[model samples]
Target: MKIIVLTSWLILSVSIAFSNAYMPLKDTELESIASQFPPLEYLNPLDDGGLLQPFLIVRIPGTENSTKVQNHVNDFFIKQISQGQNSSSSEIPMWKVTHDSFQDSTPIGDNITFTNICVSRDPELAINEGDKARTRKRLTLAAHYDSKLYPEGFIGAIDSAVPCAILMYVAKVIDKALTRKQAFLNENGVGNENNQLGLQILFLDGEEAFHEWTSTDSIYGARHLAARMENEDIENVDGLIGSGLSSIDTFVLLDLLGAANPRIPSYFSETHDLYNSMRSIQKRGRNIKGLFQHKRRESNFFSSPSVSENVHFLGGTLGDDHTPFWQRGVPVLHLIPNKFPPQWHHLTDDVDHLDLRTVHDWAIIIAAFTAEYLELTNFILDQ
Candidate 1:
């Protein structure tokens, strides 16, 4: 009799504890997430010089009618963020150097036929700034913008297109916050002393592939960049954090976020701090809404508590863009949406598969972290 009573009481306690811990996302929050990426007045149909025109179907968010509007906006941001290709920049060196063009170098001694090869500079130049109290503390949000190699049908919207767009929102917000914080500090007489904290919004160029997946095929761009940063001469770099919205920081890549709210695997337990950060942001978003009840609220998709203890093994192939950084001892937090999008790797992966609320929620989380890392508070008060 006593055993039976104890068991019942134990079950009741467990149930009550779980009930108190769980919190469902509300409608207002969803609306807030949708608003993060406002719809575009116009969209192109191809990825051109920084302007992306998504496939009409891929642009729509959700599998239902209710999310159409938000999906359109999300699609716009994703499309627009891929405006620039691998262009030459002094800030970040492009290692491609051609000694003799195909027209210049050549077929040995016989005819002197020109030959060209893409050569990478001996991974120098970009180095990590020594770990500083403020500098060593960084949260890097990385995403690859390139689509996978498939027929015209594959736009890779779910694979990584959405993640890239979301990263940009984070980049912009953090950039703004950091700049403001810097200004604040200066105005208030504080200088670079506390200006070391930073957030690197890394938009990798090639995460997809041309041929087989090898060190040279996928993640070439990010790998090359990270290698350079590890060169020991770089300055002002610290810790690293990678983020995606589809899945929590379990490092599980999101292949299909455009589907309905899919089930996320039990992967968050593998990466504790990152999981904590995700939950923290979700909590913050909820708290903000609760506090400003009369005002507006924001939607956050990553609000649930993760209960899995699954530790994801680094799948041999550095699946996404974050793989390279993770390889170099940099901590990575990958955020892939649940399940594979129906249009994944197809022309169908166009705008229709996008969700504005998803993008918006992602943007909020990114913004929060960027603000935290960059420590932009100095700008406000100093300025």
Candidate 2:
């Protein structure tokens, strides 16, 4: 993704209201969720079935390695999640997978095909209710899986490989909690009225520019998918009509992470409260033993939410996959460091340079944040 400076006028003119309440997890609850799954199973490079390995290759759009990475994502949702279930049994709740594929011209003088993979875990009542599914709001986590094309054998570990792996880990850790919540709702017969929220993960393609960064060359998959969602109308309920993009409660995009001692800032004012909530979660995680392995660092990954009135004049926001959706009025939380890692866009940005402790810490913090955002603390604790 390319970094474009935000104009002061544009930043000041934007107004959005976010009204979601965040319920913080207890110390024991955070420890329970963090310990449910192996922290380094997905981020470790030595693990053969890990999520980061397939992404550690040169996976440009319309290439063989790109397809391999896409297959790896699909297999996780299908085979890994569906383990021990019979073919015809619906005992386990599965993620509904969909794809948005298209062809577009790039600066490289070729039309490349890009596909965006989306998987969701909607409530059972929403699935059975069919047309009323639009009433369910989605909390989306996204990261681009495509690598840069300029430098040969560039892996983009911190550029986005670690971000993608972190998303996968979030999905895996929250699956059981989501299932338990669904069962509780069904047992109580609350239907979709109680919790009309779901989880969606997107693995985007063609995020890197072919040559120089331009408006049309960068974020090809995001541009197409955002436009398509804008056209599709949501089913009206209570005389309220909205597009598919409006169904999103918040769009959280992760990029340029997994490096040590990185500082992330709150880019948008609308989601500043949510950013603070994440910072609180990270603080709670630091107290948990064996969670944060680094002993010397006492600072947090996120910067203080307080900022000067002239923050926008100092190039506050960035141009990335979230730009397309944010332009259409979706509440976005951009979780990239204020200053990028030392290996940004370099050929040395590989698995060897990533900090394992930082990688595992991110997996814990993000998973805990997802649980709190979805209001799954009670169900997660019951498990």
Q: Pick the candidate with the highest lDDT.
A: 2
Q: State the lDDT of candidate 2 residue by residue for 1-383, as single tens digits.
A: 56665564353423334334566777888888656676786678777688777788888888889889889888898778656545245453568788788899998767788888888877666334454445567788999999999788898998788999888888887777787777777567675433767778989998899888777889999999899988988863333677888767789999988888888777877777788888888876777876666543356787754552224522235788988888888888888888888888988788888988888888888899998988787877744
Model 2, runs deviating above 4 Å: 6-19, 85-93, 126-132, 191-194, 236-239, 295-297, 305-316
lDDT of 2 at 115: 86
On the 0 to 100 scale, the lDDT of residue 82 in model 1 is: 27
Q: Point out where model 1 deviates above 4 Å.
A: 1-138, 191-194, 212-215, 235-271, 287-300, 303-306, 309-318, 377-383
Model 2 TM: 0.91
RMSD of each: 14.5, 2.7
Q: How well is each residue in 42-108 modelled by candidate 1, as lDDT tens digits? A: 1122333222243222221112321332333344333333235222331222222222111111111
lDDT of 1 at 199: 36
Report how far residue 281 has shifted in candidate 2, in Å.
0.5
TM-score of each: 0.54, 0.91
Q: Evaluate residue 149 in candidate 2 and report its C-alpha lDDT on the 0 to 100 scale.
A: 91
